[model samples]
Target chain A: MIGLRALATGDALPQVKPEVMRMYNMRFCPFAQRTRMVLLYKEIPHEVVNVNLRRKPKWLFERNPFGLVPVLEYNNEIVYESSICDDYLDELYVERPLYPKDPHRKAHCRVVMAKYDKMVPSFYKLIKPDENLRLQAKETISEEMKSLEIELGDGAFFGGPQPNMIDFHVYPWFERLTALKSIVEFDILQENNLHRLQLWQKRIEKLTCVKETMQPKEWHLEFFIGLANKNPQYDIGLPQSKV
Target chain B: MIGLRALATGDALPQVKPEVMRMYNMRFCPFAQRTRMVLLYKEIPHEVVNVNLRRKPKWLFERNPFGLVPVLEYNNEIVYESSICDDYLDELYVERPLYPKDPHRKAHCRVVMAKYDKMVPSFYKLIKPDENLRLQAKETISEEMKSLEIELGDGAFFGGPQPNMIDFHVYPWFERLTALKSIVEFDILQENNLHRLQLWQKRIEKLTCVKETMQPKEWHLEFFIGLANKNPQYDIGLPQSKV
Candidate 1:
């Protein structure tokens, strides 16, 4: 099911039992990856329905009028927005408890998450065709990375002994930084004084959930390259027969 | 405390007992208003320290590096971002729960909040100096108001008969629409087919929390006009003696 071609505008919605939870996802989307990571980390039994974002199916709009992915359908109810999805899952499951128990600590994680949200546009800018824009984005991202390094001070992860929701919330974009660098000839992590962040990335990458949910850098490269060329191959890694 | 002049750069930070929670705020900022509304709704005893966004106090950055308002300081721990502050307050003080008790219902509220967040840029555009941009923003906001009208179908409030956290989250922006309309000859709530939303605005405005937290429409008008003219009077409503 994971390897199936993305469902496009005219494609039929797949049948899933009402008991099972499903996620409307796009394989290359960082926002969707955050939800996918949480699902895996929490060991929630679910199905993935990859959508063609450029030519989204009509049913997708029914689930979320905004037509964005990381939309979770559970027990016939819909929830969208990556952070909201992750928070909902965490609250419902309550097994591992991704957020800190203390209200102040949880708020701190959220504050950092808010900062990361603001920095995302710069990450997207790195993939833009304009060299000057990409350079400016790199500068902004580098400055943000320094802030992240400070936030990560003396801890293996943002969650401190373990990877927390904030860690997963940010990891997808960090995971994509490599693909972005390959496309833009800039290495934000390596070239900047971000040693702590580099180590944090390595630590997060070693997690099982990260391993399971991640698409390879090469796949990201191919997808972004297609996006830059104005013809995104949403079914990039699917088998030829599946496509 | 609410009527104090906004403290600008180099101004001394006021002394508040560590036991008393404080919010770094701008009186006219709608984002700050959300936090202020939540605090009042929850009846969390807090002091407000208004800031001059035009020349923010140096110490404001110590609380929130972004130097934006609605930064909550409780027990010496800082939390910024308006939604984060509201959520932190809701979690810390559970009584009179603004959010629905059911997880799915809470998630639904969040979904609506996300839609509201996306529509805000267009609302801001209504105050822009350019007539064409204002016209375009009016069209976009009118379309979004219709969607809100549908969302409010059959319910007196988004929270269904009572305002919820999502109601407070979106109310500050809606409250400013009238002020926006006064500046630009466009009336999103009045001109569009949004009777439900128009009524929702009235219901929200009548709430005690909203009344206590909100500035008058005239204050919003004067503040916005100053903003449009590049000379924001953050301390407009304050007494001349205080200024």
Candidate 2:
């Protein structure tokens, strides 16, 4: 129930209740998924308004000038950027805090997220048409994975006992690891005997919040491969009329 | 006295007191200047350990694996990244909060920072050796300036009455704007008649914290231009001792 569906061009905007929150999202966007995971994990009362990114509505632009998902609208105020949205929500609804209560630990959490962020470009590079660039990106990804292994360093989660911002922030990239391996002929996660990283991935996969929000491996592979090939109709066949 | 000078390969590391803080910094790094400004703003007693970036010390790498400057060592715990360090310090010393108290306003402040964050690459593009790329960057910067002008929109500061994280986060770029303009023959601030932005620049420049931390405009111009020219001796003139 927490996962994505589709949106079409002619679909009417969802009715917003005074108490409920709404998020403008794309079905296949990893950035949007990060917010979705946070919302579902917190069990917040929210509606997802999936936008057909290929034909984004004018209202979507009105909501977020950058036209990015998942922009959260709460109490008639809108906020965007996945990290910012998540941070705002965590601060507003502080029951199960996504960040550490200790200031030093929280600061260290941000550094961990930043360290993982360096690998993002290489993940995108896996889909490029240039094989040379793809190979170079593979090397970069491998190097970055080694760094991640060191950071993990026998920990169950980057969030320590439970998943926090760092866990959720970086998990989206791993969701596509299967697709990246299939398309690029190698998997950085599998290669270096990254024992801690592999175990960390498994731990993330077993989480109920992740289970509800994540699409299957095949689904991710197909979706991303379609994106890599620049396919236009890749997101069709969902219940568009309802979304 | 909270400003930068030069450091050389053999410079001795500043002796750290039992309780005082120490910051590893570079004379001309805009990123490092951000943390320096924050330290000065908060009136925190800290010693500056100038790192000869051309020849970073082994201890520097031990402090931070990424070997970046603006590393803060407080209570024997090391923290790096300008924003993270500033946020940690602000949270630790709560007398003057860097972000707004209201969640909505804080989120808006983050968006303001993110918007300015997108313009950074274009600023660097002004220094690109390729004329066509430089021209393209100029256009991008102009467009981004129009966006900033819209964001500022009659406010004294991005956070309303006073400067906040957004102001400090984006001010370092303006500190080097004169250099960027002198080298590129264009001024994004002056070109669009960005009155608010220009006023904001003057206001930030006048802040005692900024005044204490900022290098002379001529110094910034010479250093950045030297960097753009790939000059290795730009950071020379300090005693070549053990850092």
Best by lDDT: 1
DockQ values, each candidate: 0.86, 0.67
- The digit string of per-residue lDDT tens for model 1 on B11-42 reads 88888578889998898988899988888888
Clashing pairs in 1: none
Q: Each prediction's Cα lDDT score?
A: 0.86, 0.77
lDDT tens digits, residues A6-92, model 1?
A: 899998888856788899899899999999989999999998999998999999999898899999998888999999999999988
Best by DockQ: 1
Every model: iRMSD: 0.6, 1.2
For every model shown, the clashing-pair count is 0, 4
For the predicted complex of model 1, DockQ is: 0.86
> Model 2 chain B — which ten-residue stretch has the worst lDDT?
B234-243
The C-alpha local distance difference test score for the whole of candidate 2 amounts to 0.77
